[model samples]
Target chain A: MPGVCASSTQSPLEGKVSKVKWPTYLSLSLVAMILGVLLVFQFRVVRYIEQGVSLGRVQELTVELRQLEKEKLKLAAEASDLSAKLQQAGQGQAEAEKALEGELEKARLLAGLVPVTGPGVEVTLDNPPANRGWATSLYVIRDEDLLRVVNELRGAGAEAISINGQRIVATSEIRWAAPFINVNLTRLVPPYHILAIGNPGNLRSALEIPGGLVEYLQELGVQVKIQAHDRLTVPGYNRPLEFRYAKPVVKE
Target chain B: MWLGVWLTLLGLILGVIVGLNIPMVLTKAHAKYLSVAVLAALDSVFGGVRAAMEEHFDHTIFLSGFFANALLAAGLAYIGERLGIDLYLAAVVAFGVRLFQNLAIIRRHLVRGIKRG
Candidate 1:
């Protein structure tokens, strides 16, 4: 049967290639081309996933952050309204008005409601040079470092403190929120500028003291810069202070 | 054999240029499905090449196999996801093994043809 088949038919198995079909060649080539395009797209998608959050998730988070910020602004306006009302009510009694005004001024200062200006020190923390290898977490500033620095400043008699223009009130929290540093719930990037209202000499000497925060941060390869200015201004806290639980005791 | 290879290469070059110029953004959730489909298509192409070398290539079979394999791979991935099982991985492993097998056969055919010449 094999011999009869070979003799009767000119088979492709005999080594003489058959004439190629143009349509089949075209279709196969088209399919291969599509596969090539898909391969590139797959590589891109994998890389994007490895780098960080998905594009859709990023967009969703951004929108949420914006909405929260708007709510914060609205609450801040309401607090200011209450403060103005309190000031107007105090105007009714002339004899006790002077003493009450003085107390109100002191309360405003402590609550970070009034902006402060004084001779103080400015500390700047920046990411280390990129050539030092990008993967190491030590080269970047962390939340704990910022907290330590703020605590040291307060200990050295800093009347007011602000990080990247966000005032650090008594209720303020400094934390790491993944790819960002959140100070008083506001997101901050690298190259942080921490301003303190205090005696310039005292603040600078406190940071530069042996085994202090500055030295510790330097050991971690973080760029730290300290400068004293004759006059510096710190903004008031922007968020509203809600006092829901505490009430002043009434004496008969 | 050389004609098919040349045609494939030309198509790839053209496809790359077109793919880069157009922005084809797929959501992150659906990226895995496309990836599995691509792998299945790749396996089918290699199988078709091996069949052609063995003198049993059929155009209809090749076309049908290409689409069917890709769709089935993607479907399996989706079903697996719904079932909370990694079904895409199964497709990946299967296609990967078959791709290597087809590649080995094609390599053997080329080497034998070279030695004969």
Candidate 2:
């Protein structure tokens, strides 16, 4: 071993004195253990960040979201079935039943349960030209603009409305979800095309009113275009609308 | 000398398996510190290997160097982050240069051993 060390080393004293001691073995092993643990931790941390998910929280949330969606669909189906049964039970009173059915249809339209088509206006809101070199804040259409436009349309007697194909139900929310606008929990990008089912003349006049939402948005440098169409179709709400707490009073 | 390598490899394998199975001890916030410390530890390991090859390996020096270097590197990184300076880059470059230098020395010793054998 000494001869081999001598051959391996440049200096002879180094060859003899640097013999591997027992304590050296112990310390090296300990260092090796630490290095090993650190390497593993580093690897795990990198993987976690890259995957963008906590150890189990993301998976748990995803499972929960899916389960809730399923429950909502089931409850919606059950509600529709009960309504149909109520309509059938009232078949004995013909005139009252017909009037009741008509009222139910109007309610369904208002509730965004059925798609509707009529003469209405389509309002398109877009960011101003990119060459303007203005800050995003200057040209971007904000959530408040969308909410005001929707309110104006409803005030103009719009029976139904849809924004970017997402039916704007009574409970639909329009707000900023960072980078995009969330309507009915669906992310929408520019340019937003808002289609309102109403009298085209009335909707256009409502928007063109002095100091109204359209003017306010235009002043903010947002491009606003309102085009009235002879016919426009608004889709039914796609998401399950479950009324968990609202129960109908039993008219005994 | 080979015994040290074997023990390190075993420890590494055991660590990986345990790390995979066990819950994470470190949080995302400490990732930068861990990275700098790992680099420092690597530099020390290579330095140890170089010392072994040169026949001047000291147990106390290697042990002290390992812990001190790791802590110092991590500390520098933490302080740099607080001070809004990238001090980990300095640690990385320094340790990286030493690691390569030690590797080169170890390689030379291995080549000499092979020729003699």
Candidate 3:
């Protein structure tokens, strides 16, 4: 297996060297070259395929949304028809009463005039102290905290909400930057204002709900105000909905 | 070409894992040898598949196909790895190259057939 060339032409030491070294060097170099080329080509292909897969996923989601909208319309029409029949028979008193109750609740929430309920405390978080430590500087408002607050607010039946004067929408984002946080891209600093246009009385208590974020923040010495604003108005969804990828795809 | 590419990818992955796990066995020199052998094997597989598909009927066809495929795969794979690229991407390029080559050959054959008719 040593360097035995065709026609049996090999020098003595050269034969041993070729047998032991040349084969290894040649094989290794060849493999290295091949691997390099393949890697380049494969990466390009993978990128192309990944883009295609992402597009396909978006198309699939669009189809699902269209199906859901059809179902919603069908259900709404059925409910309206049933209500009309009940009214014609003069047997819609209970339904009418319920509707009135709903309207009254809405008006109260709109005026921010609801009483607080349950046992909860409020702790408004302030900017880091002037003599803040390194850790405190890094303790800026994070996306997780904003998400937590929103989840808790919804759970507490918060009728409406606003952060730093900007109304919270379905697709609002609370992005964090250096020392500042954004509520739908509007920047604000401590003491961060978060207005809940709900039953102020209920909201005061909701803010202090046990096993809640407010309690945790209070322990951390964050300042929180839970005052009942008799005439606080939670601004409506004023921001336009911008769907980068959620638009319906019309199939030809 | 496609088969060759896939084989190369499989070989590359195998080589990487084996090289990492058995570091004791992977002398720089040994690694080099393994790289070449793996690439060659992958290429040979592709050539064999192509020959089978085309129904080429020479004695020693399998040996010849294997040698040719191995050499081609090794050549392409080396180019890919040197560029810090992925084996799969390399395989894709190899496939494209092979496809184009075959298409050209087929076109010539078709033209020749038309002339005879």
- Worst lDDT 10-window in candidate 3 chain B: B22-31
* lDDT of each residue in A1-252, candidate 1, tens digit only: 212211101122434233558877898889888887888778777776778686788899999999999999999999999989887776756647877899999999999988999899999998776775666555678899899999999999999999999999988999999789999889999899999999999999999999988999888888999999999999999888888998999998
lDDT of 2 by residue, B44-94 (tens): 888877777666776656676788788889999999999999999999998
Give me the runs in candidate 1 sitting further than 4 Å from their true place: A1-19, A52-78, A89-252
lDDT for each residue of candidate 1 in B1-117, tens digit (9 for 90 to 100)? 589779989998887777666576676789999999999888888877777787766665667777778888999999999999999999999889888888898999999999999
Q: Tens digit of lDDT per residue, candidate 3, span B24-56? A: 333332233244444444444343333333444
* True contact recovery of candidate 3: 0.01
- Candidate 2 lDDT over A1-252, as tens digits, reads 213211112222434456566667767777787887888888888887877767488779999999999999999999999999888876757878788999999888778989999899999999876776654455677788888999999999998888999999888999998789999999999999999989999999999999887888888878899999999899999888999999999998
- After superposing candidate 3, which stretches have Cα over 4 Å from the reference? A1-123, A131-138, A248-252, B1-117
What TM-score is obtained for chain B in each of the predicted models? 0.91, 0.88, 0.35
Regions of model 2 farther than 4 Å from truth: A1-16, A53-252, B1-5
The Cα error of candidate 3 at residue B111, in Å, is 99
Best model number under TM-score: 1
DockQ, structure candidate 1? 0.13
Better of 1 and 2 by TM-score: 1
TM-score of 1: 0.47
Which prediction has the highest DockQ against the true structure?
Answer: 2
